[model samples]
Target: MGDPTAEANRGLAVGPFAHDGVWLRCALHCHTTQSDGMLSPAMLRRYYSMGHFDVLAITDHDQLTPAPDAHSEDDDLLLLPGTEISLRSPESGGPLHVLGLGVNAMPRVPERATLLETAAAVQAEGGLAFVAHPWWTGLRSDELGDLAGVTGIEVYNAGCEVEQGRGDSAQYWDTLLSQGLPMLAIATDDHHYPGFDAFQGWTMVRAATRTPEAVLAALAAGHAYSSNGPDIHGIWIEADRIRVASSPAVAISLLGAPPRGVRVNAGPHGLKQPGDVPRGADGRRNGAYPGNLLTEATFPLLTGSPYLRVEVLDAHGRKAWSNPIWLPARG
Candidate 1:
C-alpha cells in the first residue's frame, strides 16, 4: 500500500483532524425573509445561535445579506456575508443554484449566466462558490464533471429530503470522484422553515479562530466535514490502512471507487469480542444489539483505489461524511 501521510503532505489532504483548530458548527446554506424564508435575518441569527451554531451564512436568493455591523459581547456567532445566485445550465436550461459564501458584494453577471460565468463571478468577488443540491436541480453528473472554480456540492439537503426523495446525492458525488474531480461535499438544512427543516444538517469546520475570515479560509482549504447527527472524532490514513474514530454509530463505512469500500456494521455479534455477542432483553440472540455500540474501525487500503472517503451512520439513520482522501498513483 502507499503511504497516505506522504500523499497528504503533497497537498492531497482532506480532513484536518491532525491540525490545530477549533471545530465550529456551521450552517452554510439557508435563507431569511430577505428571500422566501419564514424568518427575518435577526430571528434567523437567534435561531441558529440558540441551536449552538458557531458560524452561519445567510444565502438569500439573488441578493447579498449583509452581516450585522456590531454584535454583543455575548454573541459569539460568526455571520458571513453570502448569497445564492441562480444560473442557467446550458445542458438542461433549468436553474442552477450556486452559493456564494463570504463575498464582499454581489458580482456583475448576465441576467442568465452560465455555471462557469456564475462561478467565476463569485470567485472574482473573493467568495467561495458551491453547487447547491445538484440532485434536486436534476443536474447530471456529466454536466457537473467539468465544472471549474466551484468548491463542492451538497451531498445531502434536508429541505429536499423532507419535501421530496431526491436529496441524497452521494451517487453523483461518487461518479464525479471516479472521473478524478477532487470535489468536496457538504450536508445542509437549506432551511426555509423552522421546526420542520432547521438544524437537520450542518458542516463542522476546523478554524484557528472564531471569525468569519477564519471559517471561510478553513472551508476553502477543505478542513471540514458534513453531518446530520453523528460526530467523527478523527480520520487517519497510514501506510497500509485507514482508521476512523467516531461517536458510537450503527455503521462506519470507508467508501471508494466501485467495489472498493468497506462497511463495518454493529450486528448481533458486536465487534465479536470474546463474550460480546449481544442478546435481546429476553436473554436470546434475536439480533437486538444496541445500535450505537460501534465507536471505531479500521480498514485496509484497497489497491488501485483512486480515492477514499468515510461515512459514519448512527442509530437514528443520521450520517457524517468526510471529504475524499485522494491517493497517489503507484509508480
Candidate 2:
C-alpha cells in the first residue's frame, strides 16, 4: 500500500487499498446450523451482533445457506454468501477444505472428477475459491493445482496448528506469484463450533468501505492480510515505500515491520481479561491481563525501501499478519 489516500488520487483503482474511515470488518469464513454447526443462521447473527462483526459469510458444507434469507436480526452487519467443500473424502486420501468467497449463485459440479473438480465448480459459479488447510495433517494432496482459475489460497487457518496453503497450497501459490499470477492469500477460522469462533485465524483486508463490494474488491486485488489478531487499515504503497495505520485502541508493534526493523507501541488491550473472562478465538485464558491489548499502531515509511510486510501480535501471543507489500520496484 503507499497511502490509500494518495493512491486514491492517482486513480489507479488497483489493490484493496481504502481509507474512508469506519473500521472495515469482515469474517470470510463461518458455518451455520444448516450443516454440522451448533446454531442456525438466525442464532449465528446473535453471536456476531454481540461480538460486533461488520460482515459475515455463512459457508456450510457443500451448500450456500442463502444469507439474508436466514436473517433474524436487523443490524448494520452485512451477510455475505459462501460454502465449503472437502475436495476429497476421508476414504480417498484427500480432505482439504475449499471455501467459496462471495458466491453470487450456487454452482453445481457435473460429476465428481476429484477434489480438483470441486474447486473448479465454485469458480464456475462466479465465486472465488481457496484451498483450506491444504497441508492440514491427513488432508494433504499432490493435486494442489488440479483446480483451474482459482483466486487464491488460505495461507493461515486458526483452526489448524500447522495446516493449510502455507504448506502445500502455498508452494502452489508461490509458484503462481513468482510468475506474476496475481493470486490471493487468505486466513480463516473454518470455525466448527461457536466456542472456537476466534480460534485459529483470520485476514484483515484494506478496503474503501465495509461494504460487500469492498470485500470482493479487496480479496480480488490481494489487498489483504492474515492474522490470529490485529486490524490493519490505510495500507499504501508507492515509490519504494509502504506505510500503515492500525486501530487507535490497541497498542501495536511490528514484531518485524517490513524492511527488517520492528516498531512497538504501548496501549490498553481491546477485550476483557481477568475474572471469568470468556476467550475469543484462541483457547488460552485472558489471564490477569487488563483486556485485549489489540490497540492500534502506526508506522511511517522510514527506511525508504521498496517492499515489506506488517505483523501485529497481541499480549497473549495471538497476532495479525499482512500480505507482503511491494513498494514500487522502480520509482
Candidate 3:
C-alpha cells in the first residue's frame, strides 16, 4: 500500500512498513485436555513456553479454558484466552472452526447455523475471529466471499498437515484476497498432541509487550506473520520496489493469484533445483526438494497487482508468510 493509514483501513498494517513493535512468537490456536488435545492446561503452558513461544492462546473447542498458573511470576510467556467454535458451514456442508482470541466469554450468534454471523458475533464480543483451516474444512474460496468480520485465516494448520496432509491453505487465502478482500493469514500449530503435532506452525505477532491485550491488539492490527520455520525480519515497500529480510531462504517470492508476482531465487538462471535439494541427500529424497536459501532480497512491485504478500521458502520446505499488502488502486 502506498499510504500506511489507507493500508490499515484495508487490513494491511502487519508488515514492517513504518511499523513499531517487537516481534513475539505466538501460538494463537491450540487445544488442551479441556478439549481433544492430549496436554493438560499446566503442561500446555510449559510446552509452548519451552518451545520458545512468547504467547499462547488456550483455544479449546467452544470453551474458554483458563491458563494454568505459571510456575514463575517472572516468566514472560503471555497466555491469552480463546476458544475454537465449531460452526456449521452450510455452503461447504462441513463444520468450520472459528478461533476467538482475547475474549473471556463466547459470543452470542443470532443465527448459530451461519459461520459469518457467528464470526461477527465473536468480534462484537471484542475478540479477534479467524477462519481456522479452510482447506482442512474443505471450504471453497467463493464461500469466504460472503463471510465477514474475520481477522484472518489459519493459512497453515500443523495438526491438519500432520494428520491428513491437507494443512497448507495459501491458495485458499489467496483466493479470498483475489476477490478484493483484505484477508489476513496466520499459521498455527493447532497442536493437539504435544510432541507430534505441536510446534509445527506458528504466528509471529509484533506487539509492544508480552501481554494478552497487546498481542491480540497486534493481531487485530494485522501486525504479524505466519511461519512453519523461518523468520521474517522486515518488509518495506517504496514506490515500485519491495524489500524483504529474513532468515536464510532458498527463494523469496512476492505471491498473488497467478502470474502477477515475482520470485528471487538464490541461484542464478534458476540454478536452484526445483526445491534446492541435493541429489541423493537426506532432504526430500522421495518428495520434491523444498528450495534454496538467501537472507535478503529486493524486487520491483508490479503495477495492477491486486495483492502482494511475501513467502520465504527455507531449505526444508518450511516457510514464513507475510500478510498481504494490498496495493492501492492503479490509476
Candidate 4:
C-alpha cells in the first residue's frame, strides 16, 4: 500500500510537514499598551523581535493594532494585524474571548454576538479566529464541538498558566478530535506582562515565505504546531505507521481514539535491547537511549482509528503538540 493523497485521505488535514518550507517561529496572540498590556506597540515590537520571533500578532482587546509601517533593514520579523474580542456565549452566558489573527479590518457585529457570529465576522475580514484559553474561560468541550468558523483552540496559554492552574487544554482538543472535529491547536504566551509571561508558549508555522499572506494561508490550512517547549521537526503519516522526528525528548506519544494510542519513553534504563528500536535512514537507532532522551520514534497506526496526533514531552515536562492527521473512514 502507498501513502494516500490528501484528497484521497478525505478528512485528513496535515499541516506544512507534507511539503517543503521554512519553519517560522510565531507569536500569534499578545497584547500591548493599546489594551491591558504594559508595553506600548513600538516597545512590544522590539521585545518580540529581540526574542527572535519570526512573526508576531499584537492582538490587543477589541481593537486592531496596525503593524509597523516598515521594519528596519536589519529586522526580518513579520508583523500581522490582530485583535482580541469578547463575545457572549449562549452556552456559558459569559464572555468568550477570540483572537483574530491577520484581521486588518474591525469586524462589524453586535455587542452581544455569539461565537458563531463573531467567527463569521472575523473570517469575513480575512482573518483566522481562534478560541483563547477555553479552560480558563470555563468553557465546556461540548460547547466548542459544533462551533463553525472558529479556527482552533488555545491548547496552552502562559498567562493563564501563571495566574491560575488552568493553562493546558489538550483534554478539550482531544475531545473535539474524537468527535470528528478536525480542530487545530496553538500555544501562546497571551502576553500581558513582559518578564513574567512572554516567551512561554508559541506556534511554529511552516510557510514558503515570511509574508503575512503566506503565514496566514499556512495557519488557515492547518500547517502548524504548538509548543511551550520542545520542537517537532517532522511528522510523516504512512499507510500503516506514523513517524516523528523532534528535538530531544523524554517521551513521545501518539494520541488517538480510546485505547488506540501508544507512547514511547526514554529512561536511564532504556529499551531492553537497542535492536528493538526503529532505525532511521542513517542505519542508526531513531533516538538516543539509556541516557533518558529521544529524538525520533515510529508508531503503528491502528486500523479504523479516527485520527492521530503527536505529543513530545521534554525532560522538563514541557510539550509540543501536532495537529491531528485525520484518516479516511472505512466500511
Q: Estimate each model's TM-score.
A: 0.88, 0.66, 0.86, 0.89
Runs in model 4 deviating more than 4 A are: 1-14, 69-72, 268-272, 276-290
lDDT of 4 by residue, 116-179 (tens): 8888999999999899998898887766534789889899999999899789998878877788
Prediction RMSDs, each to the true structure: 6.2, 9.2, 7.2, 5.1
Clashes of each: 0, 23, 6, 1
Per-residue lDDT of 1-331 in model 3, one digit per residue for the tens? 1222132322222364457667788888888998899999998998888888889999999888987888676566888888998877667678788898887577776555476787777887789889999999998776654567878899999999999999999988887888778888889999898778988999888786757888888888788889999977667665556667667677777777665777766654343444442221111111233434466566666666688898988778898899888777664
lDDT of 2 at 69: 46
Better of 1 and 2 by TM-score: 1
Q: Per-residue lDDT of 1-331 in model 1, one digit per residue for the tens?
A: 1122233432222477756778899998989999999998988988888888888899999999877532456678888888989876668867688899999899776776777788889999999888898888888766643478888888889998899977788888888888788788888899999998899989989897878999989888888889999988777765666767677787788888777777776755344442342221011111434643676666766666678899988889999999888878642
lDDT of each: 0.79, 0.57, 0.76, 0.79
Candidate 1 off by > 4 Å = 1-14, 69-72, 269-292
Model 1 has an lDDT value of: 0.79
Best candidate (score: lDDT): 4
**TM-score between candidate 2 and the true structure:** 0.66
Pairwise lDDT winner, candidates 2 and 3: 3
Worst 10 residues of 2 by lDDT: 277-286
